[model samples]
Target: MTTLDKRQRVANPTYEPQPYSVTGYPTFRSFYPYYLGEHAHPVCLVGTTISLSVFVRALLAVLPLLSPAKQFAALRFGTQGWKSVGKLLLGGLLQGYVWAWIGHFFFERNKPATFKHPFYSLLGDLTLWKEVATLKRRP
Candidate 1:
């Protein structure tokens, strides 16, 4: 399959850190190609999607607890509702980590890039989803 072929090329790679810092790029224009290169393995795409989904789920859980919404929610559904929201946020966090670990260790057989470059890796994850979803990049 085309997807499997693409993954094989990136699976057994060496780490040659680019001479320039990932954060050193003044604009995303200079940084995006490097980000895409880092995530060429299909597993990275899977892990990033899982991670971002969890984040969005957590945000959805937390949004109801903010300011005016918090008061309205409390009055409408009481403490039990707030407890469920907290649980959802915690679960999202746990699931995100677990999925990321699985993707790196089992699927990619490589350490997560996020450990070294948090900001750029995150942007890579988010934009990678867009690229792949839009068929601009292949997994």
Candidate 2:
């Protein structure tokens, strides 16, 4: 299992924060390696995939309400449609975080990258999701 072996090599037994997560990087290219390092467990990668899937579904839900012909006319159901969109967004966000956090706490045995670098962590999560979804990266 080279995948697990490689991930194991990346994982540190100590749960202490790594120096990479502590400092600000000038570009996402630098932060991406650290992001991949944090998801050292297969479960962590699975969590990321599920989280992004939920986001994709949420976007799909809103697309139906959008009117491509005009601006400020996205809601076909008027105010009610806006309310549904809000709830869908909120639900997706909360659910997605829960899965990611569970992966960190249980399988990874470490803190999430989001704790130190929110922006890059988000980018990493999306990137991981894309890779996994497209079968470009193995679980």
Best by TM-score: 2
lDDT (tens digit, per residue) of candidate 2 on 1-139? 5545544443232222345735578888777766776775667666556656666666765765675655535423325676876776677777778889998888777788787778888888877666556555655
lDDT of candidate model 1 versus the reference: 0.59
Question: How displaced is residue 68 in candidate 1, in Å?
Answer: 12
Highest lDDT among the candidates is held by which one?
Answer: 2
Candidate 1 has its poorest 10 consecutive residues by lDDT at 10-19
Checking candidate 1 for backbone clashes, the offending pairs are none
- Model 1 alpha-carbon drift over 4 Å, by segment: 1-31, 52-79
Summing lDDT over every window of 10 consecutive residues in candidate 2, give the lowest-scoring window.
9-18
